[model samples]
Target: MHKIPSSEITPEHLFLSRRQLMGSAGALSVAALLAACGVRTPGAPATDTVPADARTDELGDPLNSFEEITTYNNYYEFTTDKQGVARLATGFQTSPWEVQVGGLVGNPRTFALEDLLAFEQEERIYRLRCVEAWSMVIPWVGFPLRRLLDVVEPRAGAQYVRFETVFRPEEMPGQRDRYYPWPYVEGLRLDEAMHDLTLLATGLYGRELTPQNGAPVRLVVPWKYGFKSIKSIVKIDLVDTMPTSLWMALAPNEYGFYANVNPAVAHPRWSQATERRIGERGRRETLMFNGYADEVASLYAGMDLRVNY
Candidate 1:
């Protein structure tokens, strides 16, 4: 894997300025003011225990503000409008959460929210490339998903991991829409789920996740598109056959099971060659695997990304 030079990293002072801007300016004014001032936002500080490599990605991009990340989201469980999710999910319940991990696991068990948090936590600064052709640099606080899976001990023949989100039509109005499926679902190959980069994010910016952000717990697969990282997880099943994801079920032609980020393969409606980074002025060239090709490219050595994507 390529290592980013220290000189390329954004300065700490710029991060402070960005944080200040987030607190003072409106969401619409943030990008303009920051660009004019030549300043950037900062992410939550990581503890000394966090590995140096986990503090930032190879891109050395400045972190997006808490306001932007929390306010702008793609959580369809709450709403389709990106900005409306935060407001709609405000009253949604996340407390007293428990995730059932069974299926092909030999030691299947239900992990409570507290139990999940009990695992050793680390900070990972990852770039979130959404399928919609937008991106964000997020400092996520969580442990590797492999750590949780290890305890359950996936049995032989467990080829894939299936994830299910909470189903509550009363709180999440979007769930009531019969046009789409309720209880969003996602899946990952066993190796992908076990990868070190795969995180079960509990929070961002050093604080507990809010309801809008998949609170309590969520999956963060940095190499793939943002939607692959399912939120508000309630069930996990290790199965032999590939599971059909919600988006795949909704639009099989547009959304595939392996939702990996591939700039070469454009979305049917739009080109994926470039992306508008949140909190930035203009678009930048999109990188294969969201700039994680060095780390995860080998996982698809014999496969075709265009076909799998």
Candidate 2:
């Protein structure tokens, strides 16, 4: 297993951690107020949260703490490499990096990353499974994708959401070779896109995203393989139909859009039951949704995930 750096808490990381500190505390207060008002908040059962609920491991992977997201990842398309993301991405022009939301929206508009960041971004420490077979427990820093969708106003016909990565091959060497379709494209079903678990991330390890890790912006889908969470995006197009995903287009049977982590629905050449955590000890059995089943299983209620997967 890869040795995860210890607490990778930088000065910026510290700031992000502090920000998470504030945000979570704020959320707690709100949830408390809602309870007082007889309203329900979406989360786990415990008013007294437990560390086990968000642990990313063998039998009990948990949601991310602020510490996880700001520190770990392998989003190279955003930068040349993960380490480069730490240094080069600092110069990233986030203000100009806007998300061109179009396709199936009532009013298609471009949203700047800066503005999007203003939304209630939180840290979700999820089990990140890369197509390469390695895994990581990442605490991604971002807000739910559904919040953005609410603003875009998807038309009733919108059934799929397409994500387009930055296409400036000159700036992104990976694009030059067309290792992918220049701009990496990924799609999600409407309900999946609207899931609270889905995220549009901007930071990890408590700092602004490093380019190596898909700087500027990226997507996080806990239920799917890592490839589905594209980085350095430039556009988000919603349509009545499904768009192509890199991994799925790369290998149909192996990578599906509904790439839910189910122990029963094994990858063509791999087992979904086990996983290797980034910077951790040995590989361990992966639970459904990386152990977030209790929190997210109902989202797929009555659906044969194994078939779709």
Candidate 3:
């Protein structure tokens, strides 16, 4: 766990300005956002560069620039376009939010946004590997999902956890499309949900998350493909049976329930052997369990990852 230094964190003024510029400019390109915020455009010489060794994760991968992390996103609830989410999500409401935790729990309760924030927050620099062969090193601020789970103790026979994102078709235009299911949902095995590495992320880069980045709260399971870390979470449920995730329901042959990162198990359309890290030049070999096999591998002891994935 490499702690990010204060100097490496994005300056507050620049973060605010970036949001303001995006709101006023309306659907500007990511390059335009970077240039307006005085950040070097991708592939250009950086005028303000951090040390090569600074702001790295445990694997020593340098953190992606704040611009790259925020501007480049895969929030399907907003749109399928990666860079367009930021613009469309500018007005998505997050405050006054509540997350209901129930279903086979002893002390079922709904936690308000402020209540969720009250938990002791810490920064965990993590590598977010998308299933589309792209990746980013993000410094997320939040506590373990287990902390919240403990509050609503899982009763006996609870074997899985289900997560659902908030639904507002009026604000989220993509949800209005009838082609796919609305109110995205995901799930994890009970033990996987309790793992210390499973984080309910609230913010990134030392700032509260923006709508494009899953504002208010979201899940961050570092060892799994990025989609498993569901965004804009509003409901959590403990169940005795495996929950059918949105992706799994949509394309069962393509997406699986486990969703653990395994370089050997390729997606139906492409190989998962290598991924392009944002802000980096070339592709790098994908790792088993996203390089956290040592920590999470035992969770699937004796099970074939290729089959589960």
Candidate 4:
């Protein structure tokens, strides 16, 4: 794990102004500061040198401020207001959490959050492209999802992995909306779930995940849109067929099972060709699979992304 220099760490009072400081510090200082703080630009490869074992495919710009990352989030369980979800999530409980892994698996079992942490952890800084045309570069800490799947041992019938988020109406006000689906659900092909880039994130920026950021555990599939990375996950089921995801069920034409970031395939409502970085001034061109095409393109093979998406 890389540590930021104490002198370079932004003070609490200056937390809100960190973006301004980075923007004004010029390229040289910004590079050093971003590297120290684990932030990097998205269009280019990671500027900092991590340990060889890290296996992080971090590319592009410096990271958004921790404040920006936490405050500006889309955990619909709490609320749709990105700035308000954090406050609304205070009542949510993450402890005493156990993720049930069943379905088409040989050893169906429920693993506690602590048990999930027993495996070797790796840090991966990934670019998160939202379906709404926004993006962020986040440094996440977690082990590969495959590590957990391997323990349960998928049966021959298992072809897809379905994930379910916790549902507590009292704590999650959005449940009352009756518009969007509750207990947010998401799924990925078995191979996609087992990919090295797929992570069951427990923390970000060297800190444990906060309530708004999906405390306890969440999925982080860098090659797909941010929503595909469901939050506050409670159950992971290995199924024989493609699972119905919340968004896909609500609006299949807009959201697909394989929500891979593709500039060519625009969303029904708007173009996905460009995305506005939260703290940045303007939008930047969206990349193919958010710039992980080189590593994950082959997964699609001859399959048409337009159809799968």
Q: Which prediction has the highest lDDT against the true structure? A: 3
RMSD of 2: 17.3
Query: Scored by Cα lDDT, where does model 3 land?
Result: 0.90
lDDT of each: 0.88, 0.72, 0.90, 0.86
Off by over 4 Å in 3: 1-53
Over the stretch 119-221, how does candidate 1's per-residue lDDT look in tens digits?
A: 9988888999999989989889999999999999999999999999999899889999888877899999999999999999998878787788898799999
Off by over 4 Å in 4: 1-57
- Candidate 3 lDDT by residue in tens digits, 245-306: 88988999999999888899999789999998877666899999999999999999999888
| Count of residue pairs whose backbone atoms collide, per candidate | 0, 21, 0, 12
Kindly report which residue pairs in candidate 3 clash with one another: none
Per-model TM-score on C-alpha atoms: 0.82, 0.71, 0.84, 0.81
Taking all chains together, the TM-score of candidate 4 against the true structure is 0.81
TM-score winner among the candidates? 3
TM-score of 3: 0.84
Q: How does model 2 score by TM-score? A: 0.71
Worst 10 residues of 3 by lDDT: 44-53
